[model samples]
Target: MPAGKSQYRKGEYPTFEDYSIYAQRVVLNGEFVQHSHDFDEIVLILSGTGEHLVGQRVYSLKRGDVFVIKGETRHGFRGAENLELVNVMYDPRILLSGEGDLRAVAGFAYLFLVQPAIAQQEEYPYAVFLDEDATETASTLCGFLIRQLEDCAGQYQVAVQYGFKTLAAYLANHYRTREDLSEKLGIFTRAVQYLQYNAARPIKLQEVAEAAAVSQRHLERVFFEVCGLSPMAYLLELRLRHASLLLRGTSKTVAEIAGECGFEDPSYFARVFKRKYGAPPNQCRNAKAL
Candidate 1:
């Protein structure tokens, strides 16, 4: 937080530290030179639609969508007509480690914590306006994080830190970590939430319908349209996906993972696992492929 005098006019000097949170309206056709930041980015689309160009790929974002740009993910946006958003950037360390500066981890964080997929040729998933409960909670958390960072109130640092944990958890839960077919890649965020929460259950089309408050037929039509998969098939794939995550992230036995992922028969679970992942339970667990 260093203060410096501006080149023009009346005596004026300001330190970035004096400003805890930075909020502004980024108008369309605005050219923001490519820049990188040490803190994380939480971008909330207030209205209209826009495209985020990170390198060559263009991510179409719509109103009510909130995107988390982890660290130095080399991102900038172009707003469409009538576009508005709240872009929150805060010292990532303040929200994560709480007490110290992340001078040491800045570079590494940029690679893993910030843009984990950039080098791997993967694109960060876009969390469009979907799922009322999750998106609303995220928006509230983001608002507070930005406020506390901008204000630097008493103990706001600690509060901001905790708020980030909530934000991170929500991101991981709401967005699927995959390419090709992904829940995170869809527009109906509520359906994704329902699929995530009830992935292991014997999912019914009507239930998916009810959870999203859309009729089964309507849900199927749009789910297929946006996701390229039927609602029920999407649910099955999600179960397998959760199981796949457990396969690598934990030491859960096949049977435990099977039941945990809603499959009653371990034998049947192994069959589905092999079919979906091209490997049996033991091999998958051994290889630790998620």
Candidate 2:
């Protein structure tokens, strides 16, 4: 079968070489094929209700319900009528660095790495029920990310990264901890945090969803409902913006700059840069020199 039409087989959801982090809004009308990916995912119900099958267990889902799917976990959605949600996909390491190790960051450890581990041992999929306050805060952050992704000018990468960090900090400070996972932060907040901390590194959507303790569909819905762009669009905007700055402010060669900006191909980076900025990389450098 063609990609995305039926269930995704293992390794079927290809991770892009140059980019990581992806979110998209999904409108489910009927049953979807069972599929699995190589990355983590988070799903949040925006409207309507459905049954989500993750591995062997099934969970009844409705508005404000969030589900997290580990990489390579077989899952699908069923019994739906106008079921809408956002999917946030990313890698897990996005939130951890030298000082940001998972063990060091209590929130990161609890939601992303720890919860899934426990859920796996217990043979249950991880999920949560977001309260109204948490829901609104999450919706606002998702909206902010979408806006920055769609703006298409200025230092959007910086903006998106900042937004992600703000979202993360908000969740870390406000959301419940592992001991009291009963009251949790909004799914969108966790996702934004993951994006903010890990955007500069090589990461993906599955990781982001896992970190936020949600399903990919849930992440995408808030991003679209609030900002009107997909997660990848936002990530691309970040890479190009950084590349443009390097072109204007540094003497680094285009190839070197592309690698620094997380692009595997310098030529492709140049094409994307020109498309977004209306000028070639050399022009930006030359203009700065003059």
Candidate 3:
């Protein structure tokens, strides 16, 4: 570990009881020591220039640069010249679990999942650079999100969640239109989106590769290198996550949820669910009920 690497806990930040979104604007004149946090962060550079060190890689930062830093990734900034940025830290497990519609957008998966996953492996992680107009718009959205967090008025949580989602969707949509996205990354993003769209059905590695116009072997290698999981394992995780959401939010039977989440056998689903969540579906649902 690097010297001065600090750990930032989510509990240390002010967040709503029901929502975990936190936003703050930071201005740095000198070095910010290396640190890792317990929540995902969306960084939007507002002004000036700096050097960002992520893991063992260093990248230059400037105005309009946007990227994500996943939880527990050690990163810091140095050689700062009035570097200004908005850091939107969030708990994806709480925010993304219920937003199935966002998953339908391929850019969402690419921006939040694929880009962060490949950052350590690739020379430069993919980032979306906003133009002057878009930068202004994003700054306004971040300001609104920060105000919502501060005010704590009635229905403020709702506004905060919606505000975060709006910022996320706007960035994802912008990324989708960028001409600089590499062909290989495009293939990977397509494969992830296909899996997201078809996770409720029985699918195979070959099918996923075909959807992405790549060979099964190649796809497996890419998934492992970028996502740290085999394609099949990733799909299983998606299915289980969906099943967990259904278990908590719906009155569906375990068998129904199992089937709906692409588990062909209820017994097998129960075993896998127990292994992953440390509880069977019914027990999980009952606990949620109470």
Candidate 4:
């Protein structure tokens, strides 16, 4: 993001600590000039279709798809239609802040983008599939930002912060472990599906363990290691997350959704939900009405 060359209408954002997020609508109807970014970026294709040429490689992109641009990896785009792109440029130091300050992401300097087929555990620079969680957040943030950009409201800055928060929440939760392949690769879809589908059911470690065909102890180890959560804790999160969705999206009563999503007591559900989401179910639901 440099100063005042918005003919790309592509301008740098200000005051973003770790990274900057930008929305570009490409309508040039042809190829773009070759350029590169010094920082790491994860770009989402919000609408339209195009091909990204990085060095000698040509990658096709479509709606609901995303790609990662490694630092200093030469790349450019060619859009045949109205292409909506969301670019998240990050400071590698922030990502390496918690882990050792080694340049692990520097690996991407040669690879360019992480294509979807290999987007599993090997899915370095991961992208999302059309599953419930991925699709919901992808469309929501894209739509929200597009609206803010269109309206140019005085509260646009607040909306922009919120937009980044939603993207952060989505990526922090789903980025590393995304894949659907069962054999040959331990894709995350199976584990997430197991947690969501059986959240309300009698979830014993052995059940998911056997379902995944791995031993109970091994499954427990990976659940925490890979997902950053224990089996039971993840189950609680799934139930609560779904219950929150129901509260916001429907007129359903809290008691009804609590039971539907697996809580036996409405009062206890309210207490736990409040603790997790920072508000009681009724308040969260009513906040929607506001």
Candidate 5:
């Protein structure tokens, strides 16, 4: 590993060689500019609600939500009033290729080495969500690591190694991959992910179908079966949701917010926003002000 600075400075400066494990407890009353990191990150939400823009998908965050952010992916956090969380950053090599007894295990090799390699090779910024119990266990281990790093206690490095491995193993057990999914299901899943990642763009059915390696008609069938919404319908829902968040979080005018969220027509955006939230966009902004 080498000491290198990522262009990202919204959080702490991330350097892989300085520490294999970097943990931070962050509180954001505002927003984090869209940025990317040079290393993988695990985020455990401790409190508050917010929206996480990872790639093109916007995930609504709440307590007990856990997310894995692969390296070099663009992400942002916004509209959180009292957002707090523990973010753990580590070099993938620490667990993937690092010399360790865990490497000998078949499951470990499959989860850490083989699966991640495939994901990287395929260029998918996939994320994993932990269950409630797993999230609690992860949070506890992450807390210990954060405290030890801050305290500089004796033998903290040993603790870091132990805790990091334990957390990795825990996640490996609960982790699910899309690699084993059925073709139709896999295509549908990717289509959903595509919408999440590109909902704010001028997307079309043909593009999404191509991304899934399927025809538009076939994709529509699977999407309706799995998500009960057409791709365009889902994209509209995502755009409207983003518009609502902007209305509450920033003072941007309705037109500006609409454009930013991918709605070309301000009047159409207003109509949809009003229908979804039961209030007009300007009224929503005003209500938030009070």
Candidate 6:
């Protein structure tokens, strides 16, 4: 692809308004152009070969190649023969915000989250390549998802959500079973999974590192490389996110919500919550109510 910059926005697409998800299949004979978007994308290579340009690195692409593009990460494809792929574009904040269980799946965090974070890093290895059977299965699921998205009829929204989640879970499980997963990536994935599973309880860096079978220093380095946050910081982020959702969606009191979210002190929770959200817990809740 030529060296240039372009951007795609979610609001520019019709399907984004209803469910914040869109699917499209494309065939590229030449270059697809270097561009970034405001939403995340899951790319599934259905057939043929190409060169995928991510940031400053270029990687070979082929059938069954699966990877994620985080929002605003400049990338493109070139040197294509018959590059065919399916792009599932979505707003993760909308599709995955409340799906804690799905995030806890064995390889979900690695494939969707850690991969994207480390894509441009030197340690970035390769995209997840599905075998022939898994590729066919994934393609079928994508076809059904695309059809539902195009139909856009009554109750189709729910069906589309279910279909996407099913595909995501399938891919994650496949990643979990892959024998080629890098050791560093595995450690990061395990650490993240442990953090997500135990976010509602008070957790220490030592606990997270032990869960990943790595030392605290190594764990911190991996977390910084993949998430740009320390382990404790990431846990706090998870806790605060949960607290925000509860404050908006439930009738729980501030102190109760604080404890449930793993904050031992209501006053500390309120102080930090205000620092993060720019309002006290009660005020934030009331604002959401109005």
| Top of the candidates by TM-score | 3
Runs with alpha carbons beyond 4 Å of true place in candidate 5: 1-6, 9-18, 97-127, 153-155, 175-290
Candidate 4 deviant stretches above 4 angstroms: 1-188, 287-290
Task: Report the lDDT tens digits of candidate 2 across residue range 205-278.
Answer: 77877886777787677656534656567667657755765675468898888897788887898798888877
Give lDDT: candidate 4, residue 213: 72
Expressed as tens digits, the lDDT of each residue in 129-229 for candidate 5 is: 56677777878888877876676544466667776777777766665543355576567656665665566568989999998789999988886875577
For residues 1-290, write the lDDT of model 4, one tens digit per residue: 21122122113544232223454343434566556654456676666677765555565666655555554465677654666666655533233223232222322211222232233233233334334467568767766765665565344665655665555445434442234433422523345556555666567777777766777777767766655777677778868866866775568888898998889889999999988978889989743331
Clashing pairs in 6: none
How badly does each model clash, as a count of residue pairs?
6, 31, 0, 1, 4, 0
Over 1-290, each residue of candidate 6 has an lDDT whose tens digit, in order, gives 45435888788877887877889998877777889987789999998888988887787887888888887688898887788999999876543544435776777777876677667665566567788898899999999999998998545777888888888888887742234667766788898878877876789899899999999999999878767889899888878877876786578899999998899999999999888888888998742322
lDDT of 3 by residue, 73-142 (tens): 8788888888999999987655455543677664777787777765655365465578878888999999
Error of 1 at 92 (Å): 18
**Per-model TM-score versus the true fold:** 0.46, 0.50, 0.78, 0.44, 0.50, 0.77
- lDDT at 152, model 3: 71
TM-score of 2: 0.50
Clashing pairs in 5: 56-196, 56-197, 57-196, 57-197
Quote model 5's TM-score: 0.50
Candidate 3 matches the true fold with a TM-score of 0.78
Instruction: Pick the winner on lDDT between candidates 1 and 5.
Output: 5
TM-score of 6: 0.77
For all predictions, the C-alpha RMSD in Å is 13.7, 15.1, 4.6, 14.6, 16.1, 4.8
Model 1, 145: alpha-carbon shift in Å? 10
Q: Residue 173 lDDT in model 5?
A: 66
- Whose TM-score is higher: candidate 1's or candidate 5's? 5
User: For residue 49, what is the lDDT in candidate 3?
Assistant: 87
Query: Distance (Å) between predicted and true CA of 119, model 5?
Result: 10
Candidates sorted by TM-score, best first:
3, 6, 2, 5, 1, 4
User: Considering lDDT, which of the candidate structures 2 and 5 is the better prediction for this target?
Assistant: 5
